[model samples]
Target chain A: MQQLPREESLRLLGSVPLGRLVFTQNALPAIRPVNHVLDGENIVVRLNDGATLTSIAPPAGEAGLVVAYEADAIDPHTRLGWSVIVTGYARLVADPSQVARYEELLRPWVAQTMNGVLRIQPDLVTGFRLVAQPAVAVCAAGGEGR
Target chain B: MQQLPREESLRLLGSVPLGRLVFTQNALPAIRPVNHVLDGENIVVRLNDGATLTSIAPPAGEAGLVVAYEADAIDPHTRLGWSVIVTGYARLVADPSQVARYEELLRPWVAQTMNGVLRIQPDLVTGFRLVAQPAVAVCAAGGEGR
Candidate 1:
């Protein structure tokens, strides 16, 4: 698997129509399927009253989070796919101007009604792809087919 | 989605056997599908010389991970199955006694060699399920295609 740069990584993330947004709070991990669009430099997400927004926006010290957005190839037997992840300090943009910008730039393709918060200002991001290797390669541990 | 307890959540994770093991190091995110099992309250994972292990065992301060495991029905439109998740901190256990116990408790069910570092500690676990609902409710999203 080849490593992709920041720009290409953002591109790949935006290209996928849907991804599972993973985050943690109080050491408890949570994930949800979301439709997000990549907006310059940051992986901006529009959150309703779902898991993404609430689980991450707890009190300040309690807000440590790791958000992973991934989309994989359609095949399972042959696990061929790529993913980009951003792990950083995610903060709710209560600031009016930033909120307005996110609303204007990134739009959720579909799903959810109320726009409660936006995760902006990601600290780091990277991309990876599992080559189109034989199904055996995908299993890494050999395809015991768990 | 049905809310389940600690034991059931671990069971669902063990049952799937394949999923994205997400973690971060130096704020960079990484994911890898590991053939894993549930040994009581711990997430029993067999590691190779891979990025996943490297990321999971990053300097203690920089360590955080979210294991995204799922056992969902193939057809979203059917809404006939459920998916569960377990999120928590992971540690590298070179403890021989614990490793041997896991070896007996979980036989590698996949086609992979069962030799490597094993992660067996968890801080949190949570799960969700989609009960068997009929067509009308399934299509409520209008996107869950049968």
Candidate 2:
């Protein structure tokens, strides 16, 4: 596995339209696959008003909601892929103009009208690329390839 | 989208051997794609001794590691699939017998020898199926399907 630089990580993140958003509900973790659009440095996602993520999001003034956003593209056959993880503070985008802009740019996947626009301001970014090791490298490292 | 029952969720989980495990490192969220095996009710994963997960895991006797395991299969063309999330407590399997048992049963994806065996005991399981809404159903509901 090779660690990716921050810029490369963010680029890879933007390459995928679908990803998983992870947060805690009642002190237990919960995750949902969400469609997202990258806007500069922020990750923009739409959540329904009644969705758990929207309900659990911290108020604008409060310490923003800390969540994990992850996206990846891995070939099931070759098992080669790159994954990116972003840990950020999420808050509702209350500005009407911004909300309208996002609505036009990002089409929600579900049937419900996504009235809640949440932006994740990432503080930590990390990623890794999974590459198959050659037999020579494995032997050089004193191990047998599986 | 339809909410899946517990049995269906577990069955879907068992069908896939790959998933993402989410945890916290330095108060920030982290995620890694890992290969796992369903052992009765526990989700077993192998991590190298120097891996981030093994280093951050809570030691024995303390409250087990709180983590989230998520897996899914979605078609890129249709954007339809099932996603499963399991909120669980992870603990290292110190029993040599169990470790050996798992090593033989589960093949690690990487070349490294997975020295750490972590078992996640799930406390909550939830999943959802994303099915494309038929045009008729959308029209009946007074909306247009995307």
Candidate 3:
């Protein structure tokens, strides 16, 4: 496994359309699989009515709700893929025009009445990629022969 | 989307070898993609030396550390699959015999010395499956004609 740079990590994150959103529910961690889009450096997702995440309120005098978003594209058989994690604060896009813009860009996978939009401003972005090992022994043997 | 029974949820979880482990770090949410195995009703995962999870101690008088485990098998194109979330308390397997058994059962995907074993006793299990909607209108028309 190799650590990825922030720019590369965010790029990879934007490449995938689906990710898992993690947040605190009743002080315990809760995860939901949701489709997302990257708006510049921030991650955006749509929430349906009555969704618990829509009801999460930010702490008093805080920016937004602290949450983590994780996305990966690992091959189930070979396990060779990249995983990106973004820890950030998620805030609802309350502006009518901004919500309409997001609605035009992203479509919910499930057939639900999605009206709430969330924008996550990342605080920390980390990622890793699993790559096949290089043939170091062969290179060393060839160098010796030369 | 349809809800899955606890038994079916666990069975789907065991079928997949990879899952994301959600935990608290510095009082903020953190996520890690790790491979896991189901030991009956409990989920077991291996942690390497110096891993943060290995150092997580249960609160005083508490059964274990609270954590969440999520696994899913969704088709990227169709987005039709099942996702299972298990919220529970994680405890290190300190017994030598149990550790040895887990060591034999699971192999770490990364090339790291994984010596610590964690068993998550689930407190809540929930799952949902995304299925294509049936052609109800066509069936209803055929019934009316008959």
> Over 4 Å off in model 1, which ranges?
A22-24, A27-33, A48-74, A93-115, A121-123, A134-146, B22-33, B48-83, B87-89, B95-116, B131-146
Scored by lDDT, the top model is 3
Q: DockQ of each model against the real complex?
A: 0.15, 0.37, 0.33
Q: Which model is ahead, 1 or 3, in terms of TM-score? A: 3
Clash-forming residue pairs, model 3: none
Share of the reference A-B contacts seen in candidate 1: 0.09
**iRMSD, per candidate, in listed order:** 6.3, 4.9, 6.2
Identify the leading candidate in terms of TM-score.
3
What is the docking quality class of candidate 2? acceptable
lDDT by residue (tens digit), candidate 3, A1-146: 89999999999999988999988888888888888899999999887743676678442245789899999988766667899999988988877888989976776667567868888998899999977543323222333212
Model 1 iRMSD vs. native: 6.3
- Of the candidates shown, which would achieve the greatest DockQ relative to the real structure? 2
Stretches > 4 Å off in candidate 3:
A49-51, A58-62, A134-146, B59-62, B134-146
Tell me the tens digit of each residue's lDDT in model 1 across A39-142. Answer: 66656667766454665564234554456555443334444466676656555666678777766554433323646444644566667665654444534445
Sort by TM-score, best first: what order?
Answer: 3, 2, 1
